[model samples]
Target: EPEVTQTPSHQVTQMGQEVILRCVPISNHLYFYWYRQILGQKVEFLVSFYNNEISEKSEIFDDQFSVERPDGSNFTLKIRSTKLEDSAMYFCAGKNGQRSTDTQYFGPGTRLTVL
Candidate 1:
């Protein structure tokens, strides 16, 4: 069985500082995504990447945010500037194929704390 993994499991930063969250998905997966969940809130989709390009994105993924697959194995999300409201659990997810029944595996998540 394969799963997603993230680095820097927890991050604490001052408001306005930058942060980069990283993840590695299953090697054979064809789709990758980034999501966030504010404390006690619903999981929100931030962006989805395929073929090294953004396939989908939500309003939450504004100019201040960006994502990159710097290499074949690593996917990264960067926030140019952090805000108190940006504090949340960021998850990396992936799916092997685009099927309604395909399972989307999720990483444990990186907890970002903005102070």
Candidate 2:
């Protein structure tokens, strides 16, 4: 079974700076997504991509945040400007359409610390 993976397990950025988080979803998966968990908060859905387009996205994924697949193997989330409140553990996930069972695999997560 293939698994999702995120780069730079941990990232530290300054407020008002730009940051890009990268993820590689399961090669066979049809849907790719991103989620974030703020300290002491529940995991929140950020965005989902399918067929090279955005399938869905939450309010948290505002104009400041963008998602793209620059290449066939990489899905990326970019924050144009960082904020202190943006500090969180970002997790990348992928789900394949399995008639028997729908399973979403997650990456270890990239911890973003903004100061």
Candidate 3:
């Protein structure tokens, strides 16, 4: 079965550094989303993209964050000038978008540590 996955299972970076988190979501999925979970906090939606365009974004996804489908197959998230508060597990999720009840699948997530 196809599944979503992220690269650099773990990453460590200094504050103000730039980081590009990559996600390889199920190719057949029509809708893709990005979420983050701070160490002890619950998951929060960051952004959603479809048809290679950003459909929605949460307040958490500020000017420093960007999402793209550079190759029409890979989903990528980039955080510029990463801040200490940016440290967290970033996840890539997707759904068929064919029905409201469609199950959303999520990747194991990439652990990002900003010091």
Candidate 4:
């Protein structure tokens, strides 16, 4: 089965830096989303993109964050400036549509660590 893949399963960065988390979503999937789990906290939705534009976004998606489908198969999330609070496991997810209650398949996640 096709699956979402993320790079650099683990990353260590300073408190004020830039990071680009990469993801390759399922080939045939159309809906893409980004979610983050801060250690033991609940998984919070960051943003959702479809048809080359944002479909839905949560408040957590602040000015420092951005996302794009750089090409047919690659989806990326860029953080302009990192903060201590930004350290979390970022998960990339993709879904076909809402036909089946919008089930999202998540990647193993890229664990971001800030010091």
Question: Which candidate number has the best lDDT?
Answer: 1
Clashes of 1: 0
Which lDDT tens digits does candidate 1 get at residues 25-115? 9999989999999999999999999999999999999999999998899999999999999999999999989887998999999999999
Give the candidates in order of TM-score, highest first: 1, 3, 4, 2
Clashing pairs in 2: none
Clashes of 2: 0
| 16-104: candidate 2 lDDT, tens digit per residue | 99999999988888788899999999999999988899989998999999999888889999999999999999999888883447888
Estimated TM-score per prediction? 0.97, 0.94, 0.96, 0.95
- Each model's lDDT comes to 0.95, 0.92, 0.94, 0.92
Q: Candidate 3, residues 1-115: lDDT per residue as tens digits?
A: 8989899899999999999999888988989999999999999999989888899999999999999989977899999999999999999999988577988899999999999
Model 4 — TM-score against the truth?
A: 0.95
lDDT comparing candidate 2 with the true structure: 0.92
The true-versus-predicted C-alpha distance at residue 69 of model 3, in Å, is: 0.5
Off by over 4 Å in 3: none
Candidate 2 residues lying further than 4 Å off, grouped into runs, are 98-100
**Model 4 agreement with the true structure over 66-107: per-residue lDDT tens digits:** 999978788999998899999999999999895669789999
Q: How far is candidate 4 from the true structure (C-alpha RMSD, Å)?
A: 1.1
User: Clashing pairs in model 4?
Assistant: none
Off by over 4 Å in 1: none
